[model samples]
Target: MREEYELEVLERYDVEVRSTRRIRGAFFCDTDRGTMLLKETALSGRRALLLYRALSRLEQKGNVKVDTPVFTEDGELLVSSAEGSVYMLKKWYQGRECDIRQEGELARAAKELALLHLELADSAEWSGGAKTGIGANDSTVPGGVLPVGRNPLDEIRRHNRELKKVRSFVRGRVAKNEFEYLFLDSFGKMFRIAEAVAARMENSGCMKLFSESCRRRDLVHGDYNYHNILMTKEGPAITNFEHMHVDIQAGDLYYLTRKAMEKNHWKQKTGQLIVDSYEKARRLSDAEREYLALCLAYPEKYWKTASSYYHSNKAWLPEKCVEKLKLAVRQTDEKYDFLAKTFGLIL
Candidate 1:
């Protein structure tokens, strides 16, 4: 199977494959074009090609250093595996992943992320139109103004409903494990946080602003953690756009900011620095600023822990789940502090 993939890449790109080794689901092959990484994705051929085109478009416009996929002999962007999986190959860029702890590195990453956001803010090239996972239910503003895009609060409401289900499941269990016990102990605090977040969205102009951003066709990395960033001498290169989606860029910005702050227990200083850095690249509007804080204030980690444990086989709870629940509880104050200090929230 390994040799088959390598041969396909070799014949397609016309590059000599010296050797191949597995790296993170993809095979890193030593080739004349430097180290080339070959990855098989579950995405259909059209979506895969669409993604390739988007990355190519970004690279060509000098918006960012996106590693472009190599074309096959037939001028196709993907190769097929024996089991009918799709494969993509691109140059294996040389650099270390961005370290969020290092202020300078973090700032650079934040700036690049902003630039990427700005670039994708209104990309006409991205054919993936405004995709609301659910139907676009109309939402009303204070003056009874109907926003143009989907109801943003629907997602918050949906998550809250899921949390309630998980809580109910944990309570109904015959013999609870240590993680379930921790969950039972922590559920109230988490529910309160979720309520607060929902309230913040309902009262604020968050939905209207996000609805406006929706019309902009802004793209998000979907998963924009530090690991996806490569610290090249040229600058930070964002890779792995397979998770890209069309959402209000604030979600991506919030993810990046939250991810950066989590390393330092939601330290206000670090959060401030990252937000400031991003602001320099592309300023966050009033709604986005407040919404980002609400996203942080939401007990996402706790919900994630509960959701994971609920979905898994309930023979026993893993030690890691307990540890995560504890971590979530321990960081609550710090998370609140970061939100309050950064956004001037009264909470």
Candidate 2:
């Protein structure tokens, strides 16, 4: 960013900037008070304030690791920038991301996530009259209503169709590269697996699972992974609430555990360790366990790899894409074994 532009955005925050450095699309501002993060966004005023309030409410409820948007002198969370762009200032924190390889960190992160989930769940509770939590008493917030509209199986069926479409698209290419060659070789197996998974999903009768979670107002941190968590002296501090939304909470648990499981070669012991640690915080019910099992049974990563290749602009596919397919195939194999052993069902 230009120095002149930097100074302009800094004026919105009530801090005296001593220095600035660019990091990961955000500027790190060293000010008299402390380090801060500044980034330009094209968010509308209404939407920005909604997210700002949600994040601040979470922090105020004792989830300090969640960085709340700083309010300007005029009481606005968003500051206007040059060219009409808006920006928000957040306090910068220093800590390393938790390493899942170590059992100590892994178990701690699990409990922290569970505690965080509990906080998020309780944040939606309404105790009559206006309360201290986020949209707690607001009945019109859509989160309170049961999410019974969509069938979860519909999504799997859609993805299954796309997989076949992409496979056919690749098969029709007159002259293809080595990546296409590798893709075609594994395409049949992956496609068959997707079809089977879709059939399994249809027969699982999991729509009630989705509705129950939403009716309880269990919010998910849309994107929960090791990268979004910081291993600080205070314990695990989760950051980046930009993707926070209301959803089935089990989805969040599954992603974090899947990330750890994938890293550990889909070993049952590692999966057991995570589930055991998390259950100590908030035990998973039998229905939730079944929902989580079905979620893990699907081959989402393989579908995404193929979908990404097809959607992105391309003259020739990259070699790394093919390499990822090879790794994905191997990972899917381990996942099947892990799921079969844990659930006593075919994956």
Candidate 3:
């Protein structure tokens, strides 16, 4: 029944499906042409087409290999299933998710991300010019233009607001749990760090860099994490460009470094290695380096934990939340050392 339902959506495509197997929530189809993954998506046709065009350019550059979205027989990037769900088929590769535990793999992923960003920026330049900020009405923007991401300074301010709101909620709670207690204890220090970073960002040339990048339509992977990177025999295949957008591009590096460092217990060596690996391919600008330092310095994990606890049912808090809160607090000190030794930010 499941295969029949999925096939109904896949039938719209021109591929001859020889076999199918379920992996995670998506179906892996072995077709006569090659391998493809059929999965439901909430992406609109216009946006998917935009992504497809950007990735196709990257493929031509021959630096990054991505799972390009396939169009249907009716010339649609997405096809509707019998049950009214939308699905997209992408040219899939046989490989495992990049193992973050291995430093070598992490370095490769970071370098690949740098290469991908270079191609994205170059493609943006080739696309004629920029568009309005990200999330603007797509109708207003001209076709074939990549959208810019929200400024990190603005994002940091918004996240700080959310942190304050969570703090207020927790303080008002009469009966607090371990997670809340850990949160309250860490709030003062973490919020201080957050505010400091925000202040540093405002004073630095970060905003200028963002403005220039936006004007140039510099692109970022938007979600360049371990899950989206595939470790293939040929090289690391960067997938899932549905979140791709124009930005400072260093934001992608910061995110990749953060995820890898978190897995490695915020080791200074590992963090420095990731940065060095990226710089080997593309050296970061001073503003980008500052932005990366500020991003790493901010207690993002703590803010997320507090935010999560405040939003969840207060009657029963999860133990893992408390553990995570503790980890966030503990690792933050280690992260500061990384920042100090790495980028020479004495904070």
Instruction: List TM-score per model, in order.
Output: 0.89, 0.87, 0.94
Q: What digit string (tens of lDDT, one per residue) describes model 2 on residues 1-347?
A: 46567579788767888988888777888889776788776655554565566666766777446766777777877777676666878766777788988877888878877877877775344311122333322233432221222345778888888888887998898988776777788887887887887777666646676665555556667678888878888777777666665566777888888888878989888887888888889887777777778778777777878889989766967777877777788887788888888766585
Clashing pairs in 1: none
Stretches of candidate 1 off by over 4 Å are 1-10, 125-152
Q: 29-148, model 1: which lDDT tens digit per residue? A: 888777777887666566566667677778888968877777776887777766566778876677888998998998888888899888877644355443343223332212112223
- Residue-level lDDT for 2 in candidate 3: 64
**How well is each residue in 167-197 modelled by candidate 3, as lDDT tens digits?**
8988997987787787888889989999999
Overlapping backbone residue pairs in candidate 3 total: 0
lDDT of 1: 0.75
RMSD of each: 5.5, 4.0, 2.3
Model 3 residue 180 CA deviation in Å: 0.9
lDDT for position 155 in model 2: 81
Alpha-carbon local distance difference test for all models: 0.75, 0.72, 0.83
Q: For candidate 2, list the clashing residue pairs, or say none.
A: none
lDDT of 3 at 16: 95
The RMSD (Cα, Å) of candidate 1 is 5.5
